[model samples]
Every structure is written in C-alpha cells, then in structure tokens.
Target chain A: MNTKSDILIIDDDKDMVETVGTVLEMHGYAVRKAYNGKDGLSQIEKKIPDLIVLDVMMSTDTEGFDVAYKLKNHELHRYIPILMMTSFPKYMAEKGVEKFQHILGENWPVTEFLEKPVDPDDLIAFIKELLDEKNP
Target chain B: MDQGHQLIKDQLFFRKELMERIDWFILLRWIAVALGLTGTWTAYFIGYPIAIWPISTILLFCAFYNALFFFTWRHYRLFRSDDIEYYIIFAHIQVSLDFLSLFAIIFFTGGFFSPILLFIFFHILLTGILLSPASCYTYSVVVLAAMGIMILLHITQILPPRPPLFQNITLPSSGSLFDILSLYAIFSVTIIVTAYLITSLKVSLRTKGRELLRVSKELDASIIKLKALYGMVKEMHTCTDLRTLTDSATKNAAIIMGVKACSIKLLDDQRRKLDFVSAYGLSEDYTKKGPIDIGKSPVNLRIVKGDRFSIGCIDEKEAFQYPEDIEKENISSLICLPLRVEKMIIGVFCIYSGTPAFFSSEDVDFFSLMADLTAIGIENIRNQENKAWFVKKASHQLRAPLNAAFSMLDLLEKGYHGPVDPRQKEILLRCKARIKLLGEMVGDLLKIGIKRANMKMSALFDVDVKKKLREVATFYETRATEKNIRFQLQIDESVPTIRTDPQLLDHIFSNLISNAIKYTPAGGSVSVQLSMDNKKYIVFDISDTGIGIPDSDLSNIFTEFYRSENAKECTEQGTGLGLVIVKEALDGLNGSITVESRIGKGARFTSRFPVPV
Candidate 1:
C-alpha cells in the first residue's frame, strides 16, 4: 500500500488539472486527475483522495459546486478537505462578506476559497494547511 | 392646467339637465290641455249653465298654442340640441303664452271662481327654475296686472262673463263680494312672496352647482397631471440616456403648466452661458436662438444666481434679455424659474405664454414643485449613470465558457499552477471544461468588444417588427402630446416579417424612434413608416422635424458614445451609445440604415433588412 497522501485535482480546464497534478507530484504527494464533476465523483468511488482541488466554473458555471457538495457529503470521503477556486475574485473575497453570502451561501460546501490565477506557492501553502487541519 | 377647457363641458351637462326639465314642462302642458278639453265637454254634457261653445273654443285655442310649442321643442331637440341660449328664449315665450291662455280662461269663466286659476302658482315656481331671478320677478308683476285687468272687467261689466264653476249647485254658504275680494288680495300677496323665495333659492342652488362642477373639474385635472408626472419620472428612471429622458420630461412640464411653451436651459459655469437643453411648445426658430450668455443677460443671470424672475410683457424689456428673439418667436409673457439641487443652482426652467401676465403666483408655485423634483431626478440620474458601468463590465467579463479538459497539456504550461509560475499558473488554473471557452473569449470574442458587442448571442427568435413598432409608437405618443407634436406610424400591407432576434430588432426600433423624439422640438412631428414588397429589404423610415445632424457630426454619430456638439448644447447628459448599439445589431442581422438631414430642418433614418431566404 502506498504511504503518501493521495490528492485529486478535478477541473474543467485541462491545463489547470495537469499543472496541479504536476505540482503535487513534485511535492511528493500521489495525485489523480479528473476533468469534470462526473469523472471526479467516479474517481472518488474508486479510491477517495485525502484532498481535492476544485474549480467553480466547469462544464456549467456551478458544476464545481456540485462536485464539492458530493465529496463533502460522501460517507467515505466526507473528511477530505476541498479547496474551491473561482475566476471571479470579487465574489470569493473574504472582505466582500455580503457578496460571499449572496453567491456561496452561509455554509460553504468546501473547506476554503481561493481566487483564480493563483500563485503556486500560495496554493501549496493553503493545501498544506488544509491537510494538516484534517490530519490533526 | 386649471382644467379651463372642462368648464365648457360642465356647462353642457348643466344645459342637458335644463333641457330635460323643459321636456317635462312640455309634457305637463299637454296634460293640462287634455284636462281642459275634457272638463269643458263634461260640464257641457251635464247641462251646467256654462256656455260650451265659448269654453270649447278657448280650450281648442290653448291646444293650438301648445301644439306650436311642441313643434318648437321637437325641432330644438333633434336639430340644435346644444342651442342653450335659444332654448332659454323659447322657454320664456312658452311660459308667457301659457300665462296668457290661463288668464284668458279665468277672464272668460267666473272672475273669482275660475277652474284653472291655481295653475298660476305652478307658473311662479316654474319661472324660478327656468328663468333668471329678474325675469321671475317680472313674471309676478304680469300675474298681478292680469288680476287687476280681470277686476276692472268685473266692475265695468265689459262684454260678458261665464258663470261660476259651481253656480248651478245649491251651496249653503256662498262667498260674499267682500270675502272674494279679500281672497284675491291674499292670492296676489302670496304670488309675490313665493316668487321672491324661489328666486333666492334658485340663485343659491345654481351657485352651489357651479362651484361643485369647478371643484370636481380641478380635482380631475390635478389627478391626471399628477399621474402623468409620476409616470414620466418612473419612465425617466428606466431610461439610461439623458437626452431622451429630458426631452420627454420637458415636454411633460410644458403640458403640466398648460402653457404655450416651456424650455429647460442648463448652465455652463465655465462658459458663463445658459444653453437650452430641452423645450416643449417653443418654436424651433426660438430654440435655435443659441445660448444666453449670463454676462449679457441680467434676468437669466439673476436666475442662474438663484433668483426667480419673470417678464410680464416681453416687449417691455424689463426682465427680458433678448427682445429680438422674443419678438421673433411671438412670445408675450414668461416666467424664468431657477432649477436647484440642494444649494447649488444648476439651470433655468422657463414657461412662455401668448397672453401678457398669464402665469399667476399659483402657477409659479406649482411649477416650482416640478422644478424641484426634476432637479432631484437629474442629479440622481447623473450619479446612477456614473455607477452603471461596474455591473455591465462585470457581466461582459463572464463569458459562457466552453466545455473541455486536458490534465496533461495544462500541466506543461510554465510555472503552471498546482504549484508553479504565475503566467503559466494562470493558464493552468482554468478547468479543462472551461479553458477552451476562456481561450476563445480572451481570443476571438474580444475583437467585437465593449460598445458594439452582440446581444446575448444565444437568444435569437423571429421578431415581429410591425407589432413592436406600434407598441413603441403608442408609448411615445403621450410624450408627443405634451409637446404638441404629431406622431404617426404607418405600415404598408406588403411589409414582410423577417426571422431574427426580437431583442435586437426592438433595440433598433426603440433607439431610432427615441432619438427622433429627442431631437424633435415642440410643435414638430415624428413618424415611423414600414414597407416591404418584392424588394431586397424590409424597410422602415423613421422621420422627425427636429434639429438635424451637422455634416461633420453625422460621420461620427455611429462611433461608440459619440454625441454631437449641438446635441450636447440641447442636453447636458447623453450616453451616446444608442446609434452604435443599433448599428451593431443591424450589422448582426445583415441590415443597413442611412440618415438624411439638413441642419435646423429635420431628419429621416431609412433602415433596410435583407429578406431571409
């Protein structure tokens, strides 16, 4: 059995999924990839990932939201933390609290939110923080 | 308006009521004539000591006169029902004839015991209702004179007198001469007293009726004006551009005041001039009088400095800055009101009248209310326009992304996200399902960017241009009414329906018509004509008698947000995106539009769409 943490990168953008997979691979974490919400759910059914990287707009604008919801509520994968990404930073901003609640609702289905065109260092740091929180 | 025109309408209603009462009087006269004839016949058949021949002759005479009155009444009702004055004269003649006939019957029958003597009392009351108070008093005098003549005939034993109605019956107590004379005296006094009371009562009642009518008319006028004002402001809020909104608004203000003309002049502090932004009811010759320099005009300068000034007589030159323009426009009296938003004086609102000193203090006060609301509306619109781009720009950035994903190819992007470089990171960040859409959006979609962008590219359906133009025409017609402008829409039977996006067509028609209305001054006309046959196109001609486009500005009007200098002089605000949007939408539909105009004359935009095969 593999001892390394398994990370799932699910996104509609091919480039986004490949780059995330490559980065995670470089960081020494085992990674799997899915290009859509349906494929991501099917991949989780095969073997649940320790962490998930999801995009807001996919095949549909809200498809990423649907995938995150499914993973968080799953019996086996419920503990996996999701990092949600969005191209619209205004809606994702923590300082834009009213907008956040209006678009995303009071209970965010994911562990945290991140803006698009995200820096790699910031993305890794956030992922490590979420993984540690889950593990601890 | 004080609803001055409706006062004439109220009088017509009052006269109709009066005509009904006259008809009732005619019916009663017929009843009296029937009664007289039958009563006379019955008395003669019963072998009373009365002369049947003379009594029958008198009754027939009364019937003949009544027939004449009946004919007159019928003729008036059918042919000249609105002849109020004629009816009054006819009523007087009938009343006098009835009085003479009744008095004749009393004289022929027993002087103190005539059967129809009591009808004189009804005559007194009828006179009060149908005639003026002075005429009612005069009728009472005629009554007394007739009575005096009868007394003289009784004393002198003139030709002959018919026996009393009850002379053949044996009465236990007959009336003595003293008692009869005393009763006649009492009858005369009561007739005069009744006439006095009825005259006073009818005067007060008619006055109350007139007051009620005036008050109700004023109320109706107020409600309609208020509703129109509310509808205008609400519509103004929905309008994104300034020129069209203010043009429609100025038209409304002129209508609200019931004046011949009204103009809103916006102040340019930098230029120290007041330029006419929008006007309703002003002659195009006057609107073309150019701007009023504050340094040159004392009255307008005072208004700009927040003082309300007026010229009771434009020719007097007391308050008028430009008498020559006033004379040229044939303007008489005018009120110049300061438009203010808070403490700052923004512009002047003017109302012109053909009559000298036409605007009462009340008129000025009411106009001030409209001015205050308009100032607030302008300020609010300016602020909203400034903030409108934020939401629009946001939606434009959010394109309906394409569906795709490539986990490996995206990873190859330099500094490619997951944990890599920012540029490559950005490229790698998009999900496979959305990256293709993002690429095209950043790629081809932006080539037709911003102003001339296509309508929500997905929602295309067959548009009914004819029906849509009718609805839009009906809406602008009311605004036209306020400006005394004639608006018309005509579609040829051969016009064809083209298959295209209804929204884009709507934008094309509305933007063109709205511009027509905005440029057209008061007393001008705007029209939309549609035609199509075996031609290459379904054509629409939107024409207006307005300030026409200058040759220089004409070339640039279709550029995004390009407003003409003359248009700017007429209105302080305009989005200038209307023609651009129309041009783009037409282009999308593979249609074309061309403008024909002469400065200070008018313009016509002829648009054509290729027939869809």
Candidate 2:
C-alpha cells in the first residue's frame, strides 16, 4: 500500500473510463485517461505509467489490441504491468484469452484479466496486490 | 388370295364400263357427222327435193356437239370441285345431256319411234345405279317429260310431218304403250336401290370418321400431358428454391389434371403442424386460416392413415366428422399425396375438384409421382439453406471470442502488470501473431457468409486505391524487410478513385500482401501494381517471388474447404479461405482474378475490375 501506483485507462467509453478512474483514484492510485489508442500511446511515450488498464473495444473494436501489440513490441514500454478488461461473453473471453496467450504467452507482461462490469473493490485489490508485488 | 383376286376383278369391270361409255359417245358423234354430210350430199347429187333432210342433218350435228361440250364441261368441273355434291351435280348434268341428244337423233330421223330412242332407257338405268336416289329420280322425271313432248309433237304434226328418214325399214310391231310401261317400271326400281345403297354407305363412313377423330384428339391430349410431365421433371432437376418448386408443382398439377385447385402443405421443423406453402385456386379466407394441425385435420389424418394415397368426397362424407369447412369451401373432391424424402413424409399435396368423385386411382398415382419428385427437390434446397445458416451462425458466434482474445492480447502487449522478461515478450509477440491469424480466418468466414446470403457491405464510398495500397504496403514493409525481402508498390497516377467497401478493400490487400511476405524467402521481392487497362478497367497485379503454388492446386485454390498440398506443407496457419473470400468479394464487384504460377517460380495474381461508368 505504501508503493505508489500510476494507472493509465485507455477506452472510448467516457462513462466506463470515468467510473473505473474514480474507483482507482479513491484507492489512492494516480489515474490517467486516453479516449483512444493513439492518444493512449502518446501518453505512454511521455510518461510510462506503472500499470495500464485497457478496454478492448475502443475507437474500433480491435484498437485496444493494436495499441497493446505496439507497446509490448516496443523495447522501451515492453515491461509495464498491463490488465485487460472486456465485457464479451465467456466463449468470446476464452477465445480472446487463447489469442492473447498465443501472442503474449503464459507469462505476458500483463498482470491479469478483469471481465466487466468490473467489481470496483476487486479492481482496487488487484491493483494494490500488483503494486505491493512490484515493491516487494 | 380370293379377296385379292375379287378386288382385281371388280376394278377390271369398272374400267371396262368406263371405256364402253367413252366408246359409245364417240361413235354417236361420228355417226351424226356422217349422217349430216351424207344427207347434204344426197340432196345435191340425187337432186332430191328434200330440203328437210339437210336441215334435219344439221340439227343432228348441233345436237351431237352440244352433248359433247356439256359432258366435257361437266367432267372438268367435277375434277375442279372434287366435292361430293359437285360430283352429284355433274352426274345429273351428264344424264340430262344424254337424254337431250337421244331426242334430237330421233327427231332428225323424222319419227318418234327411232331405234336410237331405246338408248334413253339404258341411260336412265345407268344414272339410277351410278348416282344417288335423288339424282336418279330427277333424271327419271326429265326423261318422262321428254318422252311426252316427243309423243305430243308426233301426234300434232309439229316434228315435220314427212316420211321417216329410214323409209326402207319396216315399222316396229311393238306398241308405244309397252315402251312407256317398261321405262316407268325401270325408273321405279332404280330409285329404290340407289336410295338404300347411298344411305347405308354415308352412315357407315360418318360413324368411322367420328371414331377416328375422337381417337386422334385423345392421343393429342396425352402427348400434351407427357410433354408437361417432361418439362416438370426438368424443372425439378434444376430447381434450387423450395418455394418456387412447390408453387410450380401446384400450378402445373392443377392445369394438367383439370382440377379446380391444388395446394401443398409442409410440416415445419417441429413436424407437429402443417403449413400451406403454395396454393393454386384456394380462397383467401381458407389461406388466412394459416397452418393446420396434421392430426386434427381429417384430410391429413387420412393421408397419414393410408399407406399409398387417399381420396375423399366432400358430399358423401359425414359433415361433422370431416368438418363442414371443406364443404363450405366448395372442395367436393380431394386427392392427398404424401411428399416423401428418404422414407420420411415432409409434406402433402392436395388437389380439389369441384365435382364429386373427380379423382380416380390413376390420378392419385400420377400425383404421387409428382409429389415424390417435389419432395426430393425440397429436401435438397432445405439442406443447402441449413448449411448456409449454420455458416452464418458459426461465424457470428466466433466473433465474440475473437474480440475478447484480441483485447486480452492488447492488454498483455501494453504491460498492465509487472515488467515482462524477454522470453515472455517473445511469447506475447507470437500470441499476437496467432490471434491475428484467427482474426483473419473469422473475417474470411464472415465474408463468405455475406457472399452466400447476397448481403451487401454496410459501408460503400469512393476510396483512392493507390493510397490504400501504399498504406497496407507500408504497414507490412518492415515485416518483409525483416526477412530480407523487398515489398514494393507500383501505382498508376491515372487510376481514379474507386467506389468500394473500404474495410473489405483493406482486408483484401492485407491478405494478399501478408501471404506474399509469408511465402517469399529472403532476397526475394513482392510487388503490388495497380493500373487502368485500355478498357477502363482497374487491374491489380500482385506478384511475389515466393514459393509458388504447384500446377495441380491452381484450379482448386479458390474453392472453399480446399487447401493446396503445397500451401499446407508450407504454412499451417491459414483457414484456406483467403482466396475464396477474395473471389467472392471480387464477384460482388463484378471483378475477376487470374493467377499464373509455376512450382519453383513466383506467383502473380491479377485482379480486374470495371470502372463505374
């Protein structure tokens, strides 16, 4: 809890971004917002955050993935902790996870997956645990 | 042998009679001419004061020529008309001419009792037998009138009251009364026999002609029915639409069977109820009743109960048991045939006739054949539709997972968690590539489904092909460079902007370029060239110095579910649907693709599209 964590939220949904941002901010975490992948990547370049929270269907349905792919491959930003969130059905989630595993492997830089509508408390707990682990 | 001999004898006799008639007419004419010349010569050589002989001889010559002209004219007219009535009229004219000539000969001989007068009786007998009774009676009356006129002239001394021209011959002992009596008796017998013979012959010929006409008409009707059956079979063979096949069958059945109405009712997938799919002449009120329960309806019950076919008469059947609806609907007779496909009854075809007892066993058999053919056609179309529907549904279901996978990969790439090690980074990159491959497969599936359903893309707009190609080329250029392969784009400046679905265009170009980069080895190059042809067609040539396809796989490259042997061995990532989707998309735009390749050499794909005028 003593370790400060900066979280970036990239999503086209203003409501989702604001809600998730407020929830993480209430837990004493620094929060940044980017409405689209292009803006999110520019923000990341200026200041690489501790953790990035990404929504899959933003700008275009696959924009979040395109941004993640570019960031993960970029040598400078490849090591940042990332948490993926989606509201798709379970079968879709499985397929998505399978694809993600294929691309990023079992030990991908991302921390974990959060299916929406995300429990605010759970989201905070995961963030705190990851931040603590980073400090430890 | 006896019948043939008798026929020949009869023909000979007829010919002999015709020749004899011709000979007599010729001999009479010659005699008349000779008599006229001799009489005139006698008057001049013997200095006889007989002016009557020359005058009578000239009259005889005129009578002969008049008879000859009348006979010849009548015979020619008979051949010209060829009608039975005209022949009858000709017969009468000939008979009349014969009588007139005989009278002239007798008068010129200066007596009422000349021997040539007997020829008139023979002529009357011949006319009675040859012609019908009507003509015979007419000739008899004329002959009697001529005889009376001759007798009156002789008694009144109006026929030149001089010595007979053959004064050397003795007077006949037979009386004038005897000649008159014999002639009257002959006329009476001729009339009776001619009437009986002609009437019998006319009645028999008419009966035979009517029977022949009836048989020929029936044959023609049968032929028409057969032709219709042949046409229906041909249509059924090629039919892909269930509704059209059912509609055509019902309409054609109603027409060919002469039924008041025909309808087809098929059970839905549940098989609990029957839905009327097509109707020919049913009332709108009945049609609005919608699908009926097969078990509840009496007509369907009978069809299900009977193994072969079922026939029901609306009038004879119990009102309550069969329902008054059918009777009120004016369907007096109903023939139901089960449409069976692979031993399962999928539907029933019912034909209604307004009259009771309209359909027979034969009608039921014929209808059953039609139903069988229709069942096969319907089943085939249903199978195709079902397959198409599954492909669409599967593609839709697959989208959700694909989206989630893509997003998850995106998050991992972004490093939302702690820093990833190099190994982890490599795995994540591989995962991204695989996810991309899955996305492309799903996209191909979607494109194929849309093509099959004939659904147009939601978005269409004018896009610069050159700009799009350059963008795609730039995106994939690094990947190609990583493998030491060259990626180049050659776009014509004159090429105008094309109206197309942008997303679809992106997909097409990405797939082509990706494949080119994937298959090409280091030191090889991939080129994408866009140009406008002479015919104002936009052509794209994507040439790759990649491991080219074999000659054997070229034809099947664009087929769905068909993977080339070489491509499978070279790469296992593709769904083998890239070219299939490309072909379908191009087909929608009225474009075509042609490929040229060799086993070891590079492959070139040429896509040609017409510029919108």
Candidate 3:
C-alpha cells in the first residue's frame, strides 16, 4: 500500500496529538505534527501537506482557527483541506462562541468540524474523503 | 422631578385656556371701538345729535387704551406658559383697567342715562369668568361705585353737564332727583346681584381646581416611588456583589423618599456591629463615621432587633445614634428601616433629610418596601455564588483528568498502544464503557452550570422545528435499531417553526429519545409526535413502552441529579441529569412540560410552547 498522502496535525493537547498521530501512521498515512499555530505555520512553510487536521482551540481560545484561516487564504497552501476538531463544543457553547459551521461557508477555509475525544476511525475516513476529493 | 414636570403641564393647560379668552376680549374691544367711532361720526355728520366732541375724545381715549391692552396680551404671549401665574395677575389688572375705561366713557356720554353704561356689565361678566372671583368682585364694586359717583357729580353739578343733542330726548341733566335716585338704586341692586351670582358659580370651580392640583401632586409623588422600585428591581438583576447591590439600592431609596441622603448598614460577620456598607448623597465624613457598636448605638441596636425608628429632630443628641455626625451633617430628620429576608434582619436602610418632619408614615411604608427588595436581592446573590463555586470546583476539575484518561483509553482500544489478549480486551471494553459513562456525567454537570450562568432566551434564533426533529431522529436511528425497537415520528404539517437555541432544542429531544430507547426492552417501540395544540401552543409528545418511572420519583424526575432505581439498574451508564437539563432548556424557551408514567407500562412526556415563538 502506498502511504504517500501527508497529513499535518496541529493541537496543543500532547496526548491527543500523540494518539491521533499514531492512529494515522498505523493506517498507512504519513503524519506530521505541530503543537501550536506558530510552529504549525513553520511546518507548512518547510513542506506543504496534502491535508491538515487542526484543533479549534490551542495556546489561545481561537489560535488553531487563526492558523487554518491563514493557510486556507494563502495561495501556496489553499488547495489543502482542513479538518477542524475541538473538545469544547460544550465549553464554547457556554462561552457564547457561534458554531464553526455558521462562521464560515462550505466553499471556504475549514472543511469540517469534529468534536473530541477524536475517534480514530472517523478521523481516518474524513482524511481519506478529503484526499479522494482533491485527487478526483 | 415628576411633580415639577406635572405642575408645568398644568400651567401650560391653564395658559392655553386663558389665551383663547384673551382673544375673545381683544375682538370685543376692537368691535366696541368700531361702533363708538361710527356713532360719534354719525352724530357730527347728521347733526341729530349728541355731545360729539367730548364723546369723540373719550372714545379715542378708549381706543388708545384697548390698543395698549392688545400690546400687553402680545407681551404675555412672549412669556413661557410656565409663567402662568404672572399671566393670571396681568389678566386681573387689565380687566380692572377695562372697567375704569368703561366708567370714563359712561361719564362722558351721560352718566346713568348713557347707553354705554350697559357695556360695563359685560366687562364684569368677562372678569368673573377669566379672573379670580375676588378680583372679579373687586372690579364689579369699582364699576358700580365709579358710576354712582359720576351720576351724583353730574346731578349735583360738581362735574360739567353736557347739552342734549336731540330736542325730544331727556338727558340725566333734565331728570328729577327722584328719577335719578331710583335709577341709582336700580343699577346698584342689579350690578351687585349679577356679581353675586357669577362669583358663587366660580367658588365651586376654584375649589375643584385646588382639589385637582392636590391630587395630581400626590399621584406624581407616588409614581416617582413606583419608578424607583422598578429601577431597584432591574439593577438588582445585574449586580452579583453585595456592596454593589447595597450601593445601588440606597441610591434608589433616596430617589423614592426625596431625601438628601441614604445609607445602608449591614450587620458584620459577628452580628455585634453595624458597618456602613453603602451610602448615596452623603458626605464622606458622614459615611466614615465608623461602624455602629450594638452596645453603644441605641437607635441602631433597636433597628437590628427589627424595630423601625423615626426621629424628627435631634434634641437629645446623646440618646440618638451618631450624635456628633448627625449634627455636623445638618440632618434634621431620620428614618431607619430594617432590611429583612423573611424574619432574619440583614441590615438597615436609612434615609436622612435636612428638613424637619420630612418622612411620614407613608414614607415609612415605601422605605420598608425598599428594604425588603434589597434583602431578597442580597439573598439571591449569596445563593448564586455558592452554587457556582460548588459546580466549578467539583465538576470542572473532575472532568479535565477524566478527559485525558478517555483519550488514552481510545488509543488503547484502537490497538495504537499494543496487542491485547481476549481476556484483557473484554476488561478494556468494560473500562471504556464506564469511562464513557463518567464523561457523560461530567458533561451533564457542566450543562447545568451553563444553564444557570447564561441561559438567556433573548439570545435565541429562529430554528426550523421539522428539520431539527429529522436531524435528532437520524442521530438516534442506529441506537434504536441496535435495541430492536421501532422508532416512529408523527409530525403535523401545521407544526410551525419556533424561535429557540438550536443546540438546546437538540439536547431536549436527544435526551428524551435516548432515555426512551435505553429504558425500553427489546421489541418495544418509541414514538415522537409534534402538532399544534389549539391556537396558542405547539405541543411535542414523546412516548415509549418502557420501564416507566415509579410514581414516587415522578415529581423529582426533572430535578438535577435524580434517577429512578429501575433506570439506574437497566443502564449503568445513565447520568441521571438528562431530565434536569431538559427542564432548564424548557425554562429558557418559556415553555412548560408534563409527564405521565406507570411503573411497568410506559411514560409519555408532553411539552407545550406558546405560539408566535
């Protein structure tokens, strides 16, 4: 099997990043990692990935969204689809943040949102669909 | 301030009425001048005659006076209607001068025999209608006396007697003394009688006007107090701190009482002293007079024991509380009310004014109301803080570590960590299930916190009810099929769209459906029906053939952290908070929910929302 499609994961939770990364690597995919928005941008600068799985909240409340917004707008990395994840649908609902789907349109930056603790099977399926859409 | 505004409004209304009356008087004066000028010119041209020169000169003088009267009316208009008192006084003086001019014209014509004497009666009637009866009666007496003096002067030859213009016509100079006496007697009786009748009618009118003004002032004062109460209630909603609440309460109390200053003194932790917590319209020195010792301050001690204290003057300075401070602040009157939550006295709300006897029994009643509201607000804040602290430290801290453990377990279950034996795998599956249950409990607790902290219905958006029902049904479709249960939906076409938080509505339906499927045995069915209930409500009924709630637990099912014994046994993963969250979410929608259940049969939950949502 050709594990050629590269996926970059940016999350502040160390254990979540490790588990999610190991799952993707085991599923025949090349996985790269960054802890926060600043390092994530630098990782993309070094080499662009085929897909990105980003966290909605990291060092700050919306740091991961900021990184995804930047990458989606940049000409070089605009083609890469983003899968946004957060453990805070409950937390952010109380904090009065509008839902991610309402903030951005379907044709724009982030492709989808998944609530955590990130299920390994769902994450792989989302990555495969995004990659297949890009190739098709 | 309200009273002042109302009084100004009353003045404007009175001024408008007076302006209309003045317009009529101005028109009458102009008409009299026109007629007087025509009669004088007619006599001079026809020679069929009267005393043309004197009558002409007097009429010209009358015209000049009336022109001045019009200018005075114009000047009155320049003054704001707020200065209506000045306008009333001006009307009195102007009408009196009008009576004087009428007397002068009658004197020039033929005294009692002059036809112009009748016009003086019209002026008397106008005065009685427009001016105070005292002024009107004064004008009446003046006109009668002036005419009587003129007739006497003419008959006794003290003033010049004019020649009769016609040969046949008899003048006052030609009449006998007896005829003149009878005329004088007749004019006196008629003028005095007219004045009596008109002034009598005006007496009841003046009394009623005074009564109306008094009632308006009382109403204005009461309205101010009501508004102050409303403002206090609104301010209480936004304040979470005791000091902030007390400060705002005292300020509003001062407004309601119309006092110079107000202060709140709370019993300190030991309950032995009254500390000044907040004060409005008070000097720094007064507020800083230090806390009151229950042993030393007699007045405060009495208030602390729940007795209201009112003092009109500070004569016995030593006996009163804060003697030197009260004298220095120039406080002439004082009212102290005990702020009580139920029977327990919490603090004292006091009002101080520089005017003696400023506060009455009515003021006491208002101050007591203010104190009661303040106490309730304080109690609510205290309770909210306690609940928030308990939820925060207990649930949130417990959830963080639980979340980390769940992520690790997910990795292990997926075989990302290592290989596992069949026995170890069984144990892992049980652990995962228990962990999921723990996580759900934490989530439910956090949901309660969110509901309490910020579940404002004002932030709701329009939601498609049919679409939401479909989404919730689809979300639970797999779970329903796993249990071999029939999941059904009966939605009416007339079930209108509702305004609510979409996530909350999803939570409500999800909890109800999830509980239904979880409790029901295999082959049992669950159904959701949405329809319009009459004209005012949209109703949702969720029913299932399930191990229904025991009748004893029905009342408490909607309370937080309550689960039936059978429910717990059937599903060890149940959080027991589903119905609590559902009830809170319904409260946010301003809706009502009811449930019917039997122990072995089933349960049906019916929720109704008001239309126009």
TM-score per candidate, chains pooled: 0.48, 0.48, 0.54
- Against the unseen true structure, what C-alpha lDDT does each candidate score? 0.73, 0.69, 0.78
lDDT of 2 at B349: 84
lDDT of 3 by residue, B429-509 (tens): 788889878878877877777687762312445888878888888888789999899999988888777766776777788
Minimum summed lDDT over a 10-residue window in model 1 chain B is located at B450-459
DockQ scores for all the models shown? 0.10, 0.03, 0.27
Q: Each model's interface RMSD (Å)? A: 6.2, 9.6, 2.7
State the lDDT of candidate 1 residue by residue for B134-230, as single tens digits: 9999999989888877765665566345655766732212435576578678988999999999999998998998898879977997788788778
Reference-based lDDT, residue B129, model 3: 82
Q: Is candidate 1 or candidate 2 better by lDDT?
A: 1
The segments of candidate 3 whose C-alpha lies over 4 angstroms from its true place after superposition are A1-3, A69-80, A90-96, A99-109, B1-15, B18-404, B416-421, B452-458, B464-466, B501-504, B550-565, B587-594, B608-613
> What's the fnat for candidate 2, on a 0 to 1 scale?
0.00
Q: Relative to the unseen true structure, what is the C-alpha lDDT of residue A32 in candidate 1, on a scale of 0 to 100?
A: 89
Q: Please report how far candidate 1 places residue B252 from its true position, in Å.
A: 3.2
For model 2, the interface Cα RMSD in angstroms equals 9.6
Best by lDDT: 3
> What TM value does model 1 have?
0.48
Residue B308, model 2: lDDT of 58
